[model samples]
Target: MQKAYKRLMAATIVSFSFGLNHQVSAQSDTYQVVSTSYQKPITTFETYIGNKKIETVRYAFGNAQYINDGVMYGSETDRVVDLKNSKQTVKRLAPAPGQIRKYKDAYYVMSLEDMDHSSLTKYTLDFKKVGKTKKFTGYGRHLILIDNKAYVLADHMKGYNYSIKLHTFDTKSFATLHHETITSMLFAYHMRQVGSQLKIYGIRPEHEEKLTVLSYDVKKQRNVKTMTTNQYVKGGVEKTQTLTKETELIFNQDRMYEINHKTKQVRVLYDSKDDLVDYAYDAKTKTYHVLEEITKTAEFRVKTLNSHFKPIAEYRLKKSDSVSPFRVL
Candidate 1:
């Protein structure tokens, strides 16, 4: 009887230990995702963990444009929200912030002072002001950090003629490296860095039949190639997400295409009936988290896809009139 009792106690102890370890493993695998509404005045930020809604934070000052390391950067308000604790911190250092990039212990922000002027400002991780660049005479649209260099894409107007320019800055010292005009005809919207090439996509002014893609070599510091495609001619490419070092995923309305930069080939990954809002890829689990909007039902669907873009699991969010389309961060 004593031996049997000891054996039962040992089995219970092992079972408890196994269950505890499993819980911890599951928690470690869980990742956080942030989504924001497209409405005005009050910007709502929704935080999710594996298709489950965890927290909703609303900022009345401005829209949150970027998120990094559990902190959300607003457009007009420098607000930071701790995802784990749901605490909000406001810092009014960079006003009218457009794009934010973090390098080492500093944060670089593009501050749009007015319609014609934009400045690149640096701040500490805790939102303390460090320094700022001289205001560029253009409207800064995109900011990208590649290696130790920071690239800013801005639009400049010389009388009625408008030109798109690319400005490069040293990340370590914030020194101006290069300021080059990319195009005088195309209204550039988005850019992606694949390998050593910076691919800029834009639409020709007054001409909407084709989308122009300009490839710029970073090492050579010159325009290398230009191509036009009819794939996303009407509205242009909405979003570009890097899938690998050599390939990226571009979204056009409800369709998603995988483009190989080396071969210059584009392949459709998924043509969904619903509108694809946003998507994110997890390299650790080889999974894709995609968010889609059901137009008929007016609901949002969170989908988990395998490495091959096959749907593995899906969850439908409750319909809400207050929130607009969501973008997975």
Candidate 2:
């Protein structure tokens, strides 16, 4: 009887230890929050923990633009906010109708919605427009500024399918350096600068199982077939990358997917359920933030989660003129 009792206690201890180990392993690593800046008519800065507001800060004037980088910069029609120093300065230039993007030393203003015609304009540090307006054809989004130029993936519709084109222009003079059709796809998934080469990561119509990462050599004015993988073209060749771990984000109508490249497993981080209004991700922090609509209240709660999908922080804000709690720009 004594031996049997001791055996039972040992098994229970082992089981308890296993459970505790699982819980710790499942917990996400502590995400290093770079900074969070969001605003409405008046700008505010905050930190959150799982739908609870920890701290709320308000700026003097203007709608705030939150850039994910640790440095805090906000813009309004008439001014810009330096959150670090808590300073607001009047914008010296004219009002821009489209979105304003700050590159290394200059700011760019362009409208992609003007499908008929569009031009990229440069502005100096003081917000004064600089040089001749750079013009490009068709509807282009996903602005990538690198090496004193602008690279964008554009789309045009045909009879049944769509044509995707990459256009590069000098940021100063807006001169067309390289313009060519890479592949015709339903849509572009992502585009970013990979070292000196511009990489376009997208899915072909029929190749949903695999993603094509196309590398373009702007100087060569041709696609580097070597760097291209999983071409997805019916007759095209395929070169696979030995991806041990990779992350891809896919945004559906109301669902946000975090995809595992090796496993090809997709986890829905945000859904339209629960009256969740909007979601945004901070790449630096590797964290996902969501805004959930509060029930029977004019207040909305903002929740922050780590990369492993663990709750980190939350915040609450009064419903104001600003519909978006966080800005991706």
Candidate 3:
């Protein structure tokens, strides 16, 4: 059963990484940061203006988990870099950093010691260890801050049974507010804040045919609604992007959809023959950018579309020897 769980987690990690590559960057209206992951051990963040590369910054560590402001947080190495200052800070704080969330003046990070042991550690702005929560009995997937509360999403597996745990803590006191365990076959991948509700996206453990969305009310401290839809492509929902307050865009490898949270209405946005690698929305230009791979030509291109999803411009990227995956910030 442990081996089976490991296999399931391995598959989930692969799919999750492909769907939501951790490309954290500092962006502006004039320029965007593009993180490129290759087969090598190095990671590069390139600042680009459309197709023109303006600045390139490389890191020795590869697994950059999170980036905020100008600081890049590395997971395994526990390395943090200030991209603006070109300085690196190494802190052996978390054994295996899962998620890092900055709330107010402190940083809260999730440490995964093993499959059954995870904990939350608090650090000062300068990476000084201040406090830590007790060990949790699951793998911490995400940590989010809402208002004055910090919410943790974790998953636990025992034998053939699976459970999802929601743990809430007060940011000011670090006191436990609520702890709830939900027994289900759903394997959650992502969680986002929509209005006052938390939208959790996951799929059934048995198969990837069905997509589940659970809306949790933070004020009530309970799940308010659950919606499941199998209206995705053959491979299932790969990624999601919030388009509006009421609607979100979900993507498969070759298809994109805009689904309403209230009505559960799904509308197809883009259906392509080629593989769609990544996508982003530019609020300044009011345009959509999608990274697509042309299999026949073995090339990658960025397609820009208007607000109505009409084609505006396209930029072809030069192919490299490494397996470079580009994300538009």
Clashing pairs in 3: none
Model 3 C-alpha lDDT per residue in residues 1-329, reported as the tens digit of each score: 99999999999999887545322111222234455443445667665666677887676655555665456665565556555554654455666777777788887778787887688888887778886565667888878898988888898878787788888978766788898775443677777777788878777555454667888898888888878664543455556778787888887676778878778777778767888877778887777778788989878777777688876566777786653645555
Q: Which candidate is the best by TM-score?
A: 3
lDDT of 1 by residue, 73-188 (tens): 66656554433443455556666778777777877788787777888887787778785565677899888888788888888877887889999988767788998897633788
Candidate 2, residue 64: Cα displacement in angstroms equals 6.0
Full-model lDDT for every candidate: 0.71, 0.55, 0.71
- Among residues 3 or more apart in sequence or in different chains, the pairs in candidate 1 whose N, CA or C atoms overlap within 3 Å are none
Instruction: Point out where model 3 deviates above 4 Å.
Output: 1-33, 36-41, 68-70, 84-92, 172-175, 183-185, 204-209, 233-239, 252-254, 293-299
The 10 consecutive residues of candidate 3 with the worst lDDT sum are 21-30
List candidate 2 stretches off by more than 4 Å. 1-40, 47-55, 59-85, 90-99, 157-162, 201-203, 208-213, 217-220, 224-245, 248-288, 292-299, 312-324
Question: Over 4 Å off in model 1, which ranges?
Answer: 1-62, 78-88, 146-148, 170-175, 204-209, 243-246, 321-325
